[model samples]
Target chain A: MELLSNLALGFGVASSLTNLGFCLIGVLLGTLIGVLPGIGATATIAMLLPITFQLEPVSSLIMLAGIYYGAQYGGSTTAILINMPGESSSAVTAIDGYQMARQGRAGTALATAALGSFFAGSVATFLVALFAPPLTAVALKFGAAEYFSLMVMGLVMSVALAHGSVLKALAMVVLGLLLGMVGTDVYTGAPRFTMGITQFADGLNFVAVAVGVFGIAEILRNLENEHDRQVMTKNISRLFPNRDEFRQMVAPILRGTGIGSVLGILPGGGAILASFASYTVEKKLSKHPEEFGKGALAGVAGPESANNAGAQTSFIPLLTLGIPANPVMALMIGAMIIQGIVPGPNVVSEQPELFWGIIASMWIGNLMLVVLNLPLIGLWVKLLTVPYYVLFPIIMAMCSIGVYSVNSNTYDLFAVAGFGLLGYVLSKLRCEPAPLLLGFVLGPLLEENLRRAMILSRGDPTTFVTRPISATLLVLSLAILVLVFLPQIRKRRDEVFTESDA
Target chain B: MSTKPKDGTDIAAGLLFMAIAGFFAWQGLGLDMGTSTRMGPGYFPMVLSGLLFILGAVILFKAFGRPDDEPMGRIAWRGILFILPAPIFFGLTVRGLGFVPALFVTTLIASQASLRMRPLAALVLSVVVTIMSTLIFSYGLGLPFRRFGPWLPL
Candidate 1:
């Protein structure tokens, strides 16, 4: 009965005119950014972070959630149309979807993508509503030791799953942890790395670091390759899928939704993994594996659905446990902090309306994406040709302004510039920024829990292994670390990454 | 054509990480670094620093084994040149020059990063971006910032 009431309340809040309008706006902006190469959902969210400050917390969250999932749907459009993915999750779609487009079946591929995403999104949203409360109930029992161990597991898994060398990822995570400790020490009340600067007392601004790394660094990276992408928008025949195509898509879509929903719950496994896993599974299951890269409708359907579903369900970890599974969720944590809401297990019991409202809005956002994107494909395709030269300047200006607005100070602008350069240099060195951000977000929490657990156990480090839940989590982290380092698994991970590029 | 060094990126990355760890460790040494029962601000940092340094060393050694990593591939020095300065210039000028003027200058500077963009087109793009940003961010969104600097007429 309580669950029913919660769902009813969520629906009521989400149906409000203001929330609905923001949802529409979020998806529209998400799709526009998602249609463009080199500007992804992570960077887009970081740039638009300032706008969330002006709106109500609930509405802002609804809008942000809308942007996150909406990007997944939009990413496939660019992948299918141009053979260039706007986001990593949609990279697989380009393999088959672009070939479909070249054969003058662009409309059919687009339709299949949209319909498959909608179906998966709907099921995943329902799964979220059903599963989130129970997950929160379990997380509520977690103590300091368990929390610390859980954070370790999350960080380790992020290292294990991140692109490039595992050693490099570990270094980035450690670097992030160090960067996070730049502010005043929580226990000692002494400024650790502030160097007597007033702004350093509060810490390096989250908005600054995120925008600099994701937004500015991305702009820098995109501009490095000034060559224009050739977008194929015309020569579309038959928008709707034929009877045979529809029948072929049904099984892949269902299987993808299941895989995505499950994978979305795992630490460091999200939309990208869900899409890649589903595509591989579908390829293996198909009668004609040869058709995979040659305009297979099932290829387009499965991964598209999986990614959308995974994007929706990825919110579960953030909402229920107050932990971010990736960089996008890390930015969400910053947004939540700004809204004066601590992202953790108690959030559901404390603010049921905000939680449920966001959940309900996701379903609505998916519906809006299908309706909005399907007809406006031509418009999105046009936006892609705006030229990066004209676009980068506006983005740069907005990024500085967005960072400045966070504290109404110029110092953070300098911080943004510094981090932008750092991001660029490190990325060039083949280190991914996601794990760093994840580690940065969790750094303070990890330290706090470690400190508290130590105090409780009188400095017995073995307490982490003695406690049941904590021990299991620590073991899982160790196991995953070991597995990632194993030659066979590492080879498979590289193949998975390469296949996405293919 | 010059031959690029193999695993050059990994070697550089490892060294940089180690340098950062050295700084953290040095700073940690300056702090109290209390016992496990009562950790000072520097205790956890020192431990973390040591671990990071060891990890960096491992990464460096590994690069020796995989020295045949895909060559560094085309460096975007043009982007590096224009993109970095654009924000620094804005930060320096925004307070004195106001949002629109600062933004205009920044846009012009950054526009040069793209080889394909002509001057007239860049100018046109700047005007449009300045006006739209002023309207949307300042007026429409009610972001509390001066539209123009004190030197400019209101």
Candidate 2:
């Protein structure tokens, strides 16, 4: 009865005219970006975040959340149709989906992806409603020391999981932390590295930096080779899979949903990992593993479902724990803060409608995507043909407008160049930006929690370890680091990374 | 662990990290780190800087070791040339030339980054983009930006 009442309340809030309108727009825009390869949800969200500042928190969030799912769905469509991924997480879908397209079964591939995603989204939305409250209650019990340790664990795991050398990632994290400390210090009010600029006193503009790093830097990367992309076909042969193919897909979709549901709760690339894991599992379980890269229906179904499920459930951490598992979630946190709502365990207890409403909106968005996409598959394929030339400039213009609108200061616009350069250099060095972003988002919180815990324990250095939860988290981080660095595991991880190439 | 130089690039990155670490450490010291109990603004930074210093040292030490050497990838100067200037021009002119002209100029410049664009085509594209953006962002959405800068002749 409690769950039913909660669902009723959520639906009441989500089904309103404004919420539904924004949700539709969000998903539509999300799909557009997803269909157009090279532009990612993170960059799109960052650019749109400023515009969202004009709307109500719930509407903005409903739209942004829709965008996330829509992008996922859109990315799959591109992958299946043209062998291009709009985002990294959809790489696995492209592997088999493109094969299906080449075989003149593109319609079946698109249908499978959409249906699998709808199923996964429905299940994961239920999972969020089921699990979020309990997780929030657990998070609410955490102390400053525990939270600090958890951030450390999150950072270390991010570093361990990141591609390329561990040292580079760690350095990037420290560098991020240092950069995060640029604003006026809370306790003493003394500025660190502000260099007398009044703007830095408030802290580096997050939108400018995020758009620069993820958006503009990505544009630069795409321009390097600027390879010509060709669309094999513009027409869908059939909209539905044959009964035999549908039956084959059932087990993989279920299995993918299961993997994604569980792993989606973890930090760093859960959706990506889930899709890849499901793909591998499906391949191994297949009687004809050779058919995997050559258009196996299960291949498209499994990863598509897994990624959608993973994307939906990845919201769990941000909603309950206030910790972002990736860059996009970090932007979500930033958006929440801009709305004057602190993100964390207290959000559910205080703003139950927001939580339940977002959950309900996600389901509605998924249903809309299913209905909206199947008939519009041709339109999306046509969208893929838009040259990068026109697209990138429009994107850049939007980025400039978004960054400038934030503080109405041109200073932040200039900051974009600096961050873009840094983002470019780091990516060039093969260093992952996830760790740096995690560090930036978590840095100040980590320092504050550390100070509080130490102060509470009379400045004892052992306080971090003496607290049981903190110690446990620290040990877990240590264990992950050790295991990740093991030669066999490292080699396997590298293989996975290289294969996914996300 | 296999100890051998991975690449010359890592060495360069390592030194960059070290230089940054040393600068932050010096700044922290200048800020006057207080005791652990009643920490000053400098204390947490110093600790972080110290850890960074160690991380940098490790990378530098690893630079003398095992196998995987690859050249640093291309810079995509075409992107750098256009993308950087696009924003700067927008910022400089957005206030003076108004959103329409600034956006028009910025978009036109940025479209040059792609080798496939013709000037006449880009010019037409810029005009459509500017008109649409002015209508959408300024008139429809009611964003308080100017449509035309003072420098533009009416």
lDDT of every model, 2 decimals: 0.86, 0.86
For residues A402-478, what per-residue lDDT tens digits would candidate 2 score against the true structure? 88887777878888878888888778877777788778888888888888888888889798898898999999988
Evaluated on chain A only, model 2 obtains a TM-score of 0.97
The A-chain TM-scores of all the candidates are 0.98, 0.97
- TM-score, predicted candidate 1 vs. hidden true structure: 0.97
TM-score of 2: 0.96
DockQ of each: 0.68, 0.65
> How do all models score by TM-score?
0.97, 0.96
Q: Lowest lDDT 10-mer window, candidate 2 chain B?
A: B1-10
Report the Cα lDDT for residue B152, model 1: 69
Per-residue C-alpha lDDT of model 1 across residues A276-341, encoded as one tens digit per residue: 899999999999999989999989999999988888888898999998877888888888999999
Q: Candidate 2, A278: how far from true, in Å?
A: 1.7
